[model samples]
Target: MFIEYIAQAPKEHQKYLKKMYQLLKEELPEATEKFSYGMPTFYWKKNVVHFADNTKHLGFYPTPTVITAFKENLTKYKFSKGAVQFPYSEPFDETLIREMVRFRKTELEELQ
Candidate 1:
C-alpha cells in the first residue's frame, strides 16, 4: 500500500516522500508499517507517526505529544497540534526529524 501510495503521488513529490519514508524506517527499524488515513504510517505499540507529501511541503505527523514536546525546536516551520509542515524550500532537517522519532519511540516504549 505504501509503495502504491508513493507511486501514485505526483512525480516531483516522490523524492521528498521517499526520503521521509527512509528516515522513519531507519529510526524505527522494529516498527510495522501500513497505510493510515491514506498516508504511510509506522506503528510499534501504537501509531508512532505518519508522513505525506503535500503541494508545497512535506507533512510530518509525529502525534500530538511529540509535536508539543518539540514545538520550541520547530518554530521556523508550520506546526499544528499533531503535525509539522516542512517547506520544500528549506533544506530537510534530518537531525530534528530523527530526534522527534526517537522521542516518540521512547514515549511508546515507556508506556509498556
Candidate 2:
C-alpha cells in the first residue's frame, strides 16, 4: 500500500515521495505502515509520521509538536502547525528529516 501510494502520486512528484519514504523508513524501521488520513502513515505506539505527494511539493506530517520543536531548523522550508511542504524542485534535507523522525520516535518512547 505504501508503494501504491507513491506510485499513484503525480509522475513528477513520485521520486521525491519515494525519497521521503526511504528516509522515514530508515529512521523508523519498527513503525508499521498504513494509510491514514489518505496518506502513507508510519505508526509505532501511535502515529509517527505521514507523507503525501502534492502537485508542487511533498507534504510531511510529523505532528505539531515535532514541527514546533524543529521550527528553527525548518525556517528554510514551508511549514505549518503539523505539516511541512518540501518543494519538488529542491533536494530534501535528509539529515533534518532523519533527525525529525528520530525525535518523533523518542517522543513516542517517552510516552511509554
Q: Who wins the TM-score comparison?
A: 2
Each prediction's Cα lDDT score? Answer: 0.89, 0.91
Encode model 1's per-residue lDDT on 6-109: one tens digit a residue.
Answer: 88888878887888888888999999998788788998989999998888998999999998899999998999999999887777899999999999999999
- Per-residue alpha-carbon lDDT of model 2 for 1-112, expressed as tens digits? 7888878778888889888888888888898999899889999999999998888888999999999999999999999999999999999899999999889999999997
- Worst ten-residue run, lDDT, model 1? 1-10
Window of ten residues with lowest summed lDDT in model 2: 1-10
Estimate the TM-score of every prediction: 0.94, 0.96
Hey, what RMSD does candidate 1 come out at?
Answer: 1.1
TM-score of 2: 0.96
